[model samples]
Target chain A: MISKVLVRLKEDVLDPAGRALTEQLNHLGFNEVKSAMVGKYIELNMDTGDREKQKERVQEMCHRLLANSLIEDYEIIHEVIEKKP
Target chain B: MISKVLVRLKEDVLDPAGRALTEQLNHLGFNEVKSAMVGKYIELNMDTGDREKQKERVQEMCHRLLANSLIEDYEIIHEVIEKKP
Candidate 1:
């Protein structure tokens, strides 16, 4: 199985990193740009037959270590991919 | 317009972060797992009609700031999706 996450700042928050990138883009001569954001994606492959239970565990992992839930939100995806038999 | 980048450890390299994540998953009772990888993704929204020039600038931005080309790799994409008028 494979699991992936997309983590990003809340829409109402100010993202300094995102703003800096936009400014750099303008400086690089892409003034037609408006705004930008910086985020993270985590990909992992494992063997799983029970996605329901596995997803629950992964969500706990995200809450404890993989993400700072106070500032960022995440989406989880679990799929049966890449059979290693 | 938007640009995104995906950064991950090279396939041949060892990732302690990834290893740790797997161990934690197993410890948390997710024994049906094999391996894991941790990576980053950056996303931005900007206004643009000239995707060619915009993509060029975004690529440069990634090289100089958004990504460290020495170890990380990136991809560039451009599209005319919205009109601010």
Candidate 2:
């Protein structure tokens, strides 16, 4: 199974890195770039075949290690990429 | 329009950050985590409503500023989130 986790700062929170990039992009002539928000993308491959179990595990991973739930929000995109053979 | 760019280290390139995170997760008892890869997710909001033009502009942004095309691979997920209003 393959799970993708996207972690990003809440809308109310400020992101300096994203702001800096947006300014740089504007300076570089990407004037159409209205806004840029940066976030983390994590891909995890696991040996499990059960989809429910995979989701549960990924949720735990996100809550425990992957994201700071206080300031960041996470979305888990789960897919069963392979079938055990 | 919203364009999401996911930037990831090339497979041949070593990712120490990803390795460190993997180790930490393992230490935290996520033994089911076969592998973990870390990447960047960037969301860009533009004023245009034309999808093709949006894609072209985003491609340029990726090539010139958003990604190190040599060592990082980028995938652009474009979506027309709202009609210009």
Candidate 3:
């Protein structure tokens, strides 16, 4: 089973890397760019069980290892690419 | 209009951040984690057009701003939540 996790900061938090990128982008003449934020994508392949249980395991993984729940929020979605429809 | 961009390192590229996280997870006793990689997701709300054109603009944005095309591969997908089905 393959699960994809997307994690990002809550909107109210300030993003230093994003601010730095905005500064650099303005210097690069991408002057019209309005917003910039940074985050992460994590993919996990596991030897797992039924779909619902797989999802639960992925969520637990996110809560335990994939994200800092205090500042970052994460979502897990899965795809079964190898199996036929 | 809204577009979601997911960007990640090409399969052969080494991810230093991910390696660091793996070490940390190991220390935290997540002994079963076999692999870890880090990437990004960017959501943009724009004033746009037909879904295809909107997607084109998003792809251009990913190429020009959201991703470092040299080392990353990115995909842009759009959702029109404003006009519900």
Best by TM-score: 2
Residue runs of model 1 more than 4 Å from their true location after superposition:
A50-57, A77-85, B50-60, B75-85
Tens digit per residue, CA lDDT, model 1, A1-85: 6887768887877899889877877787767668877777787675656788678777877887678888898878676775478
Docking class of 1: medium
- The residue pairs in collision within model 2 are none
Candidate 1, backbone clash total: 2
* Candidate 2 Cα outliers beyond 4 Å, as residue runs: A82-85, B83-85
Q: Which candidate, 1 or 3, would have the higher DockQ against the true structure?
A: 1
For residue A5, model 2's alpha carbon misses the true position, in angstroms, by: 1.0
Rank candidates by DockQ, best first. 2, 1, 3
Better of 1 and 3 by TM-score: 3
Isolated chain B TM-score per model: 0.71, 0.91, 0.82
Please provide, for model 2 over A20-79, each residue's C-alpha lDDT reduced to its tens digit, 9 standing for 90 to 100. 988998999888888889999998878786889989988999999899998999988887
How high is the CA lDDT of each candidate model?
0.73, 0.88, 0.73
lDDT of predicted model 2: 0.88
Query: Candidate 3's residue-wise lDDT over B1-85, tens digit each?
Result: 6666789898899989878876776677654556667788776655555778767766766777778978999877677866758
Whole-model lDDT for model 3 versus the true structure?
Answer: 0.73
lDDT of 3 by residue, A5-73 (tens): 888887888888767765665566544445666778887655565788778767777788788998898
Model 3 CAPRI rating: acceptable
